[model samples]
Target: MRRRAVVAAAAVLTGGVAVLLGVAVPQAQAAEVSYATRCIPPSGIGLPPVDGTTKVEITAPAAAKVGDTVDVVWTFTQAASRNPDIIDLPADSVQPSGTLKAAGAQSADIAMRGPRQNPPVPKGGAMVLSAMKGSLKLTTAGQVMLTPDAYVVNALSTDTSCAPTQQVQPAATITVTAGSGSSSGGTGEPSHTGTPSHTPTKTTSPSPPASTSTSPSPSGGSGGQTDFTGKVVNVPYTCQSPIGQKRATSPVQINARKNGGSYDLTVQFKKSVMDSPIDIPANSVKPAMQVVLGGADKGSVAVEGPKNAAPIKQGAPIEIPDLTGVYKPGATGEATLSPGVLTIDALGTRTTCTPDSSTVSLTLDTTEQAGGASGATGGSGSSSSTAGGASTSGGLAETGAGDHATLKALGLVAGTAVLLGAAVFTYLPGRRRTR
Candidate 1:
């Protein structure tokens, strides 16, 4: 079988801020440029992986709505720490570049906007969210799918894009998988870990909504619960990507072992990643990982499936790759599952593989309508009750919740003062929050 090489066209990034932010719609005020790269499985022909034994990881929500503030993090590994002190490799030396295209090509587009921060060049370890804080905004609700034509471009000099001994992984894609559901949270500066914490500091963007968003009721689980103590399992996952252009799925292998109270998560990809490796730049770095966990059982039980979806649920630890160790494996996914029940347990194991900010949620799609479950799929069933977490306010992802509610209270105070001087007028402060 003749392998086809996936190539990249290095074009001067255009459109200025408007294009960069994807603010092509009338609703958008501003936008920012987002990053992307193409990483095909080793079976498929593509660019070789980076030489530094590095991996580039990008994280964002599985689904977003119009006016939603989506937080995007792109992590890279830096060489500043390994060989310290004197200036060696310069900054912005390595770029995993690409263009973002939404599925169905709606009239509106997803804008990459606001307060973009440069990730710190770590002296050692992996560089995280503090590294790249790119916010995503949807202009059209109809735009559900996203595909980025990702490719790498190294600025350093070399006879070719690769060196004789550098490790190389093929450019993979960053896509929205599983159900297209949105999440709610506050924004924060990304660090070398790329993980978003519970309560992040405030950003210039608008605050999160007062009420949390909810999602579909937690449904039945496909069976396969495992106690992955010193074991490895090859898990098959299905996601929608490469839309008409390319369709591929990496063979996933999960390596888990009990570590004291929690299970350690390690993963490997068969015939995946850049075939070999590429040269590592002077001071730049690649991603190690950003782990994602979800489902109703947050213990040693890991729910493995698509985003906003679940066909299989079992006991296993989750993992996100990082630059802290040799990231030889291919790559994992970000937005491929649904909002069942999720929590991070990466208290130990790897340091840089922090809990990722990627989130999926279940909403109050229905209530007990004085009737029992219809006992039918997609029916008016009473059993499929959604435990509400749906966000009422149209807040941005990663932004702390409740601030919008606080702002609403303040607005109410002002209204109350005016009402006292006149009639007893009723007001709903947070009504206008969700766009």
Candidate 2:
């Protein structure tokens, strides 16, 4: 009898331990896959389409039940080809978001967003994209296959959209079953990320009333225009010139006319001395300005002026013509306009000038249209053509081996581009000219 009781006690203890371990640990599933990815950068930065490989690792629960919320995570084990223009990418500068295609029992797209995290990368190194995290609710019980899809990487205010060059295979498979009990924080709705469901409904009713009240104002008559001129401000700029990095202050005058549906803007820059290392040919220098809109509106307008009429000597003062662009107000309020990046294309070589201080040059009160349509869409404006050679405009410039054959002939590579991007900021005496 004593021996039998001891054996029973040992069996009970072993069963209890097994039950405790089952409750504490959950089964996890993971898969690793490689994708041939191609990225098209934002226009005007003069970079062609870039091709590279992206290795992704996906992690999720191996098995889930109906109404259970499952957590999913994706890590970019390897990023795309390195961009030479991005010499220094600060930590937490990159934000990654992507979509996952779910098939089998549920047909939906699971969107994932990751927190910002990255170690300090040295110059000439590829950027480390952040990992993405998302979740999904199992509304039905069946096996679901999760496949990786296209993604976007927004780094340093530049957005690079990447897609797979070929058909993508499923990365991981999830087995789902009917829930034995209530699901852990699960709603009976389909799983979707990003925007809420009620957002579209809210916009339908409120826009008409908002447009009617704001369109008619005393300052701006119906179908009439208002003009604001002679607004002058000094803007300091740091430029990467052919000679070297140079700093100068130029007087910028802004004129604004609020048309019924849009605003016409004129930006004039004063004469400044630019000592070039090489002679710039006649009609070689094409300059463009990014008119940044703030306050009631947020976006940029690209304005281009005519090229130089005469050749610029090695050491000579450069006279830039007036730049003009159209601004369509997307919102109703006082909009402030400031001078942003100034890109000068001289002799097939591109020089970028970034303003140290963006002082507000003009402000105009705007209203929405009567039809409930916003005046203009928000974002960077259309790119203007370069004069001497093909160059990129606005944001970070992208250079690839396939598109830059001429640059390669001139002995310009990723390293040379890195030096050009690392422009030091300094202040110079303000030069003024009247229009």
Candidate 3:
């Protein structure tokens, strides 16, 4: 009886311990898989150079296993060029494996235009708004997917183009492989790496609007996502002669990532530029405040030298001159330029160019003949009758002589002889005796 009691008590105690152990194991596993990601601006990193006029950050994994969650964070340094009325920062989540799981915005601070010291932000301080967070549970997963989200930014007192509101979003679906240990942050500038935080000491005066004009709808991704154009400096084009006839349309687009803000853009043109100057104004765009293009020579469209060369920013239109009369055939023109420089060759003479501002204007002349000129005259005047007669006779003789060379030659001689005989016998001094 004593042995039975002892055995029963021990079994009960073992069962309790087993239950506790099972719960503890699952809790530990969940903690490792679940992580909160944050997007700290350069300011958060305590770096003076952490500000991106516009910035996008990834702070978490999209598709996590059960008990796994991803944290994504985004940052906006300044206002973007398009949709000035709003500050757009949109994001989405997907599950590639396991389950799509869940997602949310977590927390967001709106940086609105402010006083010179604090500087008014685009949307101002964080306001109760939609898209603060999102929850998506994927039952099973083969391909994890994420979509874009648009955030509204109200107008602050400091902004000149301030409107009621604006929208922002990302460019594409950022993805990572299962168990790939992906960090949840953006691939932007360097981080502060645990530096002491310090806000800007002195605020720079707000620059004037580049332009007040609006433009045609700009192209971009779904969530304020303009097409992101790659570095396009070395593309070749035909240059006209007398230094003024090379034009190029940027085939690449500036894509605004779902989370939109200001961007530091650098364009490099070829060096052989010798034509009239180029013009990229800031008055033909919308929200973008500034667009600075570097790397070119001293030349301007409708103006003088390189120093006089103005910048192209948001709300500004690029004014390109008519290149038809400028680029003549058989001439050489050169334009050393960087990107964002538009040019058109009237003569269709494509030439290679470099990135030297000293050579921004070039002329390319046609080496081939011009139109409306006769071949014998070397593209000059009409052919004379004698020349025409000679050409016709030469061509006819060459063509006919191949088939009836002897017969044709004999017939010509016979005709000449008969004409001469008739002239002499009837009209010359040895006339007919009967008359």
* Better by lDDT, candidate 3 or 1: 1
- Among all windows of ten consecutive residues in candidate 1, which has the lowest summed lDDT? 344-353
Q: List the residue pairs that clash in candidate 2.
A: 44-392, 44-393, 45-392, 45-393, 46-392
| Whole-model lDDT values for every prediction | 0.24, 0.57, 0.21
Tens digits of per-residue lDDT for model 2, 128-238: 777888887776677778888888775433456778998888888888877864434223345444321111101001111111112223433344547766356666666
Candidate 3 lDDT over 1-435, as tens digits, reads 999999999988888899877632221111111111111111111111111122222223433542234333332332222221112111110000011121222112212111112222121222111112223222222333332222223211010111112233322222333343333432222212111122211112112222212121221123343323333222222222121222221111121111232111222221211111112222211100011111221221111112113443212222322111010111112212122222211111111211112221221111222341212221121112211111110000000212211111111111111111111111112222221
**How well does model 1 score by local distance difference test?**
0.24
Top candidate when judged by TM-score against the true structure:
2
Error of 2 at 166 (Å): 1.4
The lDDT of model 3 is: 0.21
Q: In model 3, what is the error at residue 281, expressed in angstroms?
A: 21
Between prediction 2 and prediction 3, which has the larger TM-score? 2
- Per-model TM against the reference: 0.19, 0.44, 0.16
TM accuracy, model 2: 0.44
